[model samples]
Target: MIKKAVIPAAGFGTRFLPATKAVPKEMLPIVDKPNLQYIIEEAINSGIEDIIIVTGRNKKAMEDHFDRSVELELLLEKTNKHELLNTVEQISNLVDIHYVRQKEPLGLGHAILCTKKFIGNEPFAVLLPDDIIDNEEPALKQMVNHYNDVQSSILGVKEVPHNDVDKYGIVEIEKSSTSLYPIKGVVEKPAVDVAPSNLAIVGRYILTPEIFDKLENVKPDAKGEIQLTDAIESLRFDQSIYACALEGTRYDVGDKFGFLQATFDFAMKREELHEPLKKYLKEKLEE
Candidate 1:
């Protein structure tokens, strides 16, 4: 029962630039709701009860978004805005969310290490909120189901084009099934000539606590940042780690193009926005 999940939201979104100067990237809204909220909802839907969000400076907005506001609720009630009120109220009650500040700008592995006190000896899921996954089955839930059967760490993997393999952490897999692969090796952003496979590691992960020990032994790179990929690779020495191919569309919302694509896809799915957005896209295409 992997009841706890950790979300690393501390990164400085230099990719988004000026807009992210003050606002945390996780707070960036997808349509009307913040991206982090969607990630939280995904966790809740996957039966995750305890959520530990690893945040950094100027991340109060992320915290506030999940907190209850009595005045706002009362005002909504007075205005008879039941729908809006329910939406606002539901955010606070979705799950047991806890926040921990990552005082410095460390790497993904460090941010996850911060949750050791909370996670304490439990196998936990790590959801990078930026990788918004849309599927008939929530991505994390699918990973969890697979985790139950394998009882090993699972990494969400998706097939990328051979040309794009250099842009991602490519996995060297041995025995491969239709939806799962036994990860024999992992290289972070390898050159095309050296890429062992086109299976790229994505954001979602179900990690065992032994990873903490591996992370502690990991040396920081030239940028003075620890790489989670390195730690996971080190853990491979002790146990079997698998790459579970996701049965869904994954949008790397941290990237500008990916964000726009996700917004358009999600919007098109809405009944009210479908026709209007489709008409607007057709009009723009004509120009």
Candidate 2:
């Protein structure tokens, strides 16, 4: 069983600029909750009992966000804000969450490698906070279910426009009729014409303990950062790795436009904001 999950959030989100200068990108708010919280909730919903968040310097805020805040709780209690108090308490007691410092912003692969000691010798799931997937069946849960059936590594994949193939790690898959495709290999940000397939790897993965060895052996790319895709490609040579087409609407909250879209979409779902937000948008569009 995949009881442990890792969230590699050590990256300095330079894309978000001044806002991210002092704040970890993972801690950025989506609606009322931090982006990382959604990913953690998804893991818990997927049956993961423990989570190790790989963090870095200046990421203390992320840790504090999950930790208890007695002062704030007392304030909320004193104000009789029971709803807000319960929400705060629930976040602190969500799951058995732990943290490990990545020490440097080497790369996603390196961040994940830092969690080896906590993972020990077991299969685990990796979820990227950037990809906030909204679905009836949580994206991570779908991957977890697939992992249980195959007993092998699973990569959450989604088809992308051919023109955008260069934006993602494209997977080469053997022809399959089902949503699950047998991954032949993975190419990181290949040119559109050269991309093996339109299926791009998103932020979710269920990998075996053997991947740690592959990650350690992977040479850094030209940027001197180890890439998880490169390690996964190498691991594919040793074991079967399948890409499961995740059924969901994925919002790439790491990008500016995507973040806005997620914010708007999430706002539209809230009962208090739905009609007013819709009316506002409709009026703006008619302007």
Candidate 3:
């Protein structure tokens, strides 16, 4: 069984600019909870017990957020805030969380490669926390369950507009069934005319151990960082790779506009924030 998950959280949030100067992007709060927590929760819910978080220099705050807060727990207990206390306590107890420093802002492939010893020849999942997926079933759960059945390296794919295919890694797949497709190959952000299909690879992956060998020899791009797409393409030469079309709305929270959309969408779904947010939106529209 795929019992472990690796989260690559070492990136410098250059997109968010000055705000991210002091904070890790993964630590940014979507509402009340840090974004990384949601990803951890998703992994735990998908039956993944061990989690390896690849972090970097200024990500100490992210670590602290998941650690036990004795002082805060005492204060909440003394105030008789049982619900809030339970919430805070659950953060640390969620899974067997471990941290490894990526040491540099190499790339997603390098961040994942750092966890090789931890993974130790086992199939594992990699989740990019920046992609917040809203679905009836957790996105990773769908992919994990699919992986369990197929026993192959699987990627989470979602159909994108033809024009937008250039913005993501596009998968050339052969449909095996209605929901699953075998990824023959993948092209990272190909030109519109060159893209094989509009099915874009997203942030979730169930990767096999053989990927580490490909990553070790994967050539770096002009930016001198090993791209995960390159390694995956190489891994395709040896093993079967499947792409499962995701049944959910994905928010690329790494982008400002996508972040705002996710915030508004999630907030509107909450009973406490729904009416107020709706009323505020109506007022703004009228103005």
Candidate 4:
């Protein structure tokens, strides 16, 4: 059973710009809660017990969110705000949260590699905070449940348009079933003329212990940092890689325009804010 998950949060969200200079991109507000909270909630809902977050410098606010704020709790208790208390308490109740400093802004592969001591010999999960899936079936859980049956490394993949394939890690599928497929190999940002398929690997993975060894020998290719996709490719022959296109609408919050769209959609999901938000957006459109 995949009971552990590692979320890499050390990336410099340059796309978000000056705002992100002080604020961590993962902590950006979605609707009622911060963005990282949603991702953390997803991990907790998926029955993941040990949640490891690989964070870096100036990211102390991320840790503080998970940690208990004693004074704030007492203030809420005094005011008899049961709802607020319950909401604040949910953070602690969610999971056994652990933090490991990535030390430097390496790469996603290095972030996962840092959790070796905590992971030990178990199959762990890696979720990218940038990819937020809106669905009843959590993306990681979907992949892990499938991995439980197959007992092989599984990646959360979704079909993209032919042109957009170059923007992501495109999977070369050997065979295809309904929701799952046997991925032959993956090409990171392949050119349009020589592209394989439209299926792109998203931000979810259930990887075995072999990946750790592969990551150790995996050099920083052309990119200065270790890429996880490279390590994933090296494990191809030894094990089969199954791609599961999860039943969810993925919003790439990392993109500027996508982030704006997500903010509007997520706000519309809120009961109190829906009508008002729509009205305001309509008014703005008219202006």
Best by lDDT: 2
lDDT of 4 by residue, 1-287 (tens): 98999999988899998988988999888866778888888888888988999988778888888888888899999999979998898786678888999988778889999999989988888889998988998888888788878999998998888989889988888666567788889888899888888888888899998899999988896668888889999988789888888888888998887777788888888899999988998999999
Q: Model 2: per-residue lDDT, tens digit, 1-287?
A: 99999998888899998999999999899888899998999999999999999988899998899899999999999999999999999999999999999987788899999999999999999999999999989998998888888899999999999999999999999988888889998999999999999999899999999999999999999988989999999999899999999999999999999999999999999999999999998999999
Better of 1 and 3 by lDDT: 1
What is candidate 3's lDDT per residue for 1-287, written digit by digit as tens? 98999999988999998989999988888877777887888888889999999988888998888899999999999999999999999887888889999987778889999999999999999999889888878999999888878899999999888999989989999967568898889998999998999999889999999999988999988888988999999998888899999998999999999888888888888899999998999999999
Q: Which candidate model has the greater lDDT, 1 or 4? A: 1
For all candidates in order, the CA lDDT equals 0.91, 0.93, 0.90, 0.87
- CA lDDT, candidate 3, residue 266: 81
Given candidate 1, what's the lDDT at residue 24?
92
lDDT tens digits by residue: candidate 1, 67-93: 998999999999999999999999889
Worst 10 residues of 2 by lDDT: 140-149
* Angstrom error at residue 129, model 2: 0.8
TM-score quality measure for candidate 2:
0.98
- TM-score each candidate: 0.97, 0.98, 0.97, 0.96
Clashing pairs in 2: none
**Model 3 ranges off by over 4 Å:** none
Residue 237 displacement (Å), model 3: 1.4
- How high is the lDDT of residue 236 in model 1? 95
